[model samples]
Target: MDTLAIVILNYNGQSFLAKFLPTVLANAEGYPVYVADSASTDGSVAFVRTHFSAVRLIELPRNEGYAGGYNMALEHIQTHYGGATYYVLPNSDIEVTPGWLDPVMKLLDANPQIAACQPKILSYAERELFEHAGAAGGYVDWLGYVFCRGRVFATFESDQGQYNDNQEIFWATGACLFIRAELFHRVGGFDASFFAHMEEIDLCWRLKRLGYEIWACGQSTVYHVGGGTLHKSNPHKTYLNYRNSLFMLYKNWPADGWLWGKFLLRLILDGVSSLLFLKVGQWRDVLAIIRAHFSFYGRLPHLHRQRKALLKQQKAEVPLYPHSIVWDYFIKGKKTFEAIVETSEK
Candidate 1:
């Protein structure tokens, strides 16, 4: 029988895993389940050992962040697990619904050209609503901002046959993505430079460049408890999001001019945004933006080197028009960071 390896990256997500593991194991029977824990001090490793000894656990020496943790686990899945045809990367905070795995695996089996397939992810807390991070499928804008089909920003719509149609997307959410192990290895897995945020987008972009398609399997579904591990407003999260976004733009743009132009636009927009946040007495958010930019500057040289190497190997045609890949499903308005924070907290 063909084998599958389900890789879950954990970091003090014991509460989430306590509920998620059983459901995943029940649905993902006959597959090798692996948990790559990032040295959680909250008894995450001990809990797994006590309750789910069947799960192959690899405790890291330190917190290597999400991308690094997954990469470490991917290495084990490939080398040790041997016949793992599919590698499913699910966040520790998600619950897999019944019959979800079959559709995802079936789609991959049917379409050999598809490098990855993701299930429809609904919010775990609000069953009807779509999650903020990656609702249905992922898309990228001209300025390198990534969004999804069913939801955008704070405007999440209920998933009621809106994205029922199966289609190819620019990328899939890292929350619950399944890919052919060979294709994943061919793309060198998630870019470790990302550390955490937007790594999936970078991986999917590389897969597309290699002449492979990323599909959204509408039939399969999973529930995502958004921001279960990292709070949405964390400054570290902000830094990674900003830095990795810039890295993605630099690496994927057809030319250097495009990358520079986007960078300038982002800087101007972020500056204005920071000023507005400061005006509204949201000094913390203002500082977050400032710190994000400063962090990006500190890592610019390393990012540039990586971008140069990636661009040198690219032979695929970059889409000239943004609308070709970006579908704007969210409304636009000038909103302060404070407003977003307040709304999310509610």
Candidate 2:
């Protein structure tokens, strides 16, 4: 039997952990589980130690965001569990359905070119609804926005038979990404600069450059409670989502007109969005967007150097069609964000 190491990054999620740990442990047969705690104040460390004695715990001194926390935990896995053939980065708020891992591993075993695979993620809270974060698989737009199958922004509908067929995708969500340990190391793992959002996309883009395929297995499924740790309405998450997207574009896109063209388009859209939010008095979101732009600008030089180095290492350019991934997100005549704010105020 091939060894597997499950790396779960925790941050003040004791409440979820109470339920998450048991479900994960039950599904994690023939695998070792590692809980990487990011200095949770809510006795999360103690809870895990008491309940999951067999699980390895790596408690950080302080919160190092998502990327840092995972990287820290990965170092231990690489050293101690070097024999692990598969490495799973599962979020702490997910419940693995029966036979989820077997399908994913089987696909990876059969397809030597496939570097990573993700399970069909369903919504935990909404039950019948597909999870907004990463419904089945993830894809990106030319404008650098990320969307998933069975969902696009607030347009999540019933699964139906939309994504029943298993196929290759541009990227897989980090929430439940499974990768071959060797390929993960080959592409150098998730970019730490992202800190959180879109890091998986960045990693997958790099893996594609190295001649690896990312797939979504329809047979494997998991339930994810959307916004379990960070509420969707939270300004902090909005900021990270926006900022990290820009960082991703800079790092992954070819260092030429393509990169600048996309970056400029994002700038225009974000600027308009900020103004629109201000007009409607969504002050927190507006401020969050501003902060994200300024923070990214501050680190432009370092980001440029990193991009140059990464581009040089690329062995091949994977062609992705824009229309295949570009989604409207505003389905069924849904009200736009501005309209929602206006109507709410009225």
**Which of the numbered candidates is closest to the native, going by highest lDDT?**
2
Q: Which 10-residue window of candidate 2 scores lowest in summed lDDT?
A: 332-341
Q: Candidate 1 on 83-150: residue-level lDDT in tens?
A: 37888989999989889888778788888988888999899999998887678888775767666767
Task: Give a tens-digit lDDT track for model 2, residues 1-346.
Answer: 2468888999999988898788888888758888989999999999999989988888877777777777777776787656378889889998888788888888888999998889888898777777876787877766777667777666676767567668898898888989888777766677777788788888898888878899998888889986777788898988998899888888888655777767787898889878977898889999999999999999899989988888888887866435312223342342232232233355
Could you estimate the TM-score for every candidate? 0.89, 0.90
Model 1 alpha-carbon miss at residue 189, Å = 1.7
lDDT of each: 0.78, 0.79
Alpha carbon lDDT at 191, candidate 1? 83
Superposed by TM-score, candidate 1 places the C-alpha of residue 27 at a distance from the truth, in angstroms, of 0.5
Model 1 error, position 217 (Å):
0.8
- Give the distance in Å from residue 86's predicted Cα in candidate 2 to where it truly belongs: 1.0
